[model samples]
Target: MRSLTESDIRTSFVNCSKGEAQRLSVPRDLGQLPWADLDFLGWRDPGAPDRSCLVAEWRGGLLGVTLRFPPSRRGLRHRSMCSLCLTTHPGGGVSLMTARKAGAAGREGNSVGLYLCTDLACSLYVRGRKVPESGGRLEESLTLDQQIARTTGHLSAFLDKLYA
Candidate 1:
């Protein structure tokens, strides 16, 4: 994958906000990534649980999406999927992730909780950077490049809604 410039990221947001495009993400170097396989890009904020992000590429541009994880008293439910890794769990591995809405329409606090893979592997998911599993070869269908692009697209759309 190619590294994305700040302008590229900003432009993606603009396009998605206008409903002219889908979401995308900031591109990072995929040299160290497993380029031969991947499906999406996913990552959690190192500093905040409430701040997680994803990105993907679509058409010819990048899409970045951000999500907010509010603290919830309800226990996590089973059979949830991680937005970043696409991993589904039968137990409490997923949480609700909400994206902000665009424009004045979202001025009143609107968000969504997407059941996500508990192991935030957006980066590995998109770039095929995975830890060796003891059992067998992990599902590696899409190339790392495709994973990054798809992740970026999803992310960009999500962020646009949040700030919109």
Candidate 2:
């Protein structure tokens, strides 16, 4: 991953219109990001609780997506796993985030969703830099590189769907 500017983030979006991308909130901490540790950069929009964003480098180019987290009724009763980083979150830490499909399909109201970390901190979780706050267990036997690969693959699959 590389440090990105607000323009880089906005221009990288494949699923939204230029005007929409320009208006959406980009993370305020672009300069402070630990790029070496991120498979992708993701953040929640502070003004709109349901809005989130993710951007990654893929196939020699950058691709970004804007996501929406519908308010959940389950809250903390059940546990869910992030489809990308494969981290397990107890309670309601895992959110079902959806991005509108790229191009015309998106304009027609189509979307794609995945269960992911509520705060979009999958990269940190996978790197062992951050831990789930619930004092729960994440008993994965895979090595660090393997875990990173798996998470990247999952996100790639989602991007593939958007491009398809």
Candidate 3:
């Protein structure tokens, strides 16, 4: 994935009003991100723990989505797999994130949800740069590049649903 600028990210959002996109926070350390290794960029909002953002190179350009999740339930710990990267996590590490559907459907309160890494670090986990809190990723016969492709494919499918 190519490195993105703040303006690029803010303008790429398809599901939110321009004002909301402008108000959303972009990562402060964009310059330090591992762009070459990323299939997409995702992060949780530091100021608003329930809010998260994701940006990816889709079709010919960038696509951004805003996501929300309920507050974590304290003392709940169980293993769950992230649908995007297939990494398993315990407790609050995985969240059921919901993104408002694009345009009119979103205005009608329609949304799409998926189990995802609470930290929004699927790219890092798939590449072995970050480890899950519980057991590691399942052993796979596919090569590292193949694993990366599978992860990206999952993400693309989810994005496709947004436009459906």
Candidate 4:
């Protein structure tokens, strides 16, 4: 992953109108983010808790999607695993994030959802830059690179659904 400018992030969005992308919140500390460790850049909108976004480099280009998730239900705690990186987290650490489908399907309210890290930090968790508070990574024989490959493979599959 490479450091991205706000312009790049805004322009990379695929499931929303240009005006909507322009209005959405981008991380303020873009320059300080751990780009080298990120499989994709993802963030939840601070002003709009239900809104989230993800951007990744795919097929020689940047692909981004805008996602929406249900509001959190307080006081409920459960163990859950991220579908992308396979890292498990306890309580509110995982979220069901959904992205509207691209093209006419989106216009018709079609969307896809995946269980993901609530904070959108799967890349960091998988690489040990960050850790899950309760649930943790499973012991596996696969090397770090192999784990990364598996994570990206899951992401690519999710992104492919949007392209369809």
Ranking by lDDT: 4, 3, 2, 1
Worst 10 residues of 4 by lDDT: 71-80
Q: Judge candidate 4 at residue 59 and give its lDDT.
A: 82
* Model 4, residue pairs in steric clash: none
Q: Please, what are the lDDT tens digits per residue for candidate 2 over residues 34-72?
A: 999999999988878899889999989999899998887
lDDT of each: 0.50, 0.87, 0.90, 0.91
Q: By the TM-score metric, which is better: model 1 or model 3?
A: 3
Per residue, candidate 4 scores C-alpha lDDT tens digits across 1-164 of 99999999999988999999999999999999999999999999998889889999988889989988886663447678899998888777788999999889998899999999889999998899998886568998999999999999999999999968
Predicted structure 2: lDDT: 0.87
lDDT of 1 at 9: 46
Q: Give me the overall lDDT of model 4.
A: 0.91
Model 1 agreement with the true structure over 1-164: per-residue lDDT tens digits = 45544455445442135342223333354445443343334466555656666545644655555666755454434355555445444454556776655446455656545655444555553443454222222476877666566555665555545554
Worst 10 residues of 3 by lDDT: 71-80
Candidate 1 or 4, higher lDDT?
A: 4
Q: Give each prediction's root-mean-square deviation over alpha carbons.
A: 7.3, 1.3, 1.2, 1.2
**Once superposed on the true structure, which residue ranges of model 3 sit more than 4 Å away at CA?**
74-77
TM-score of every model versus the real structure: 0.50, 0.94, 0.96, 0.96
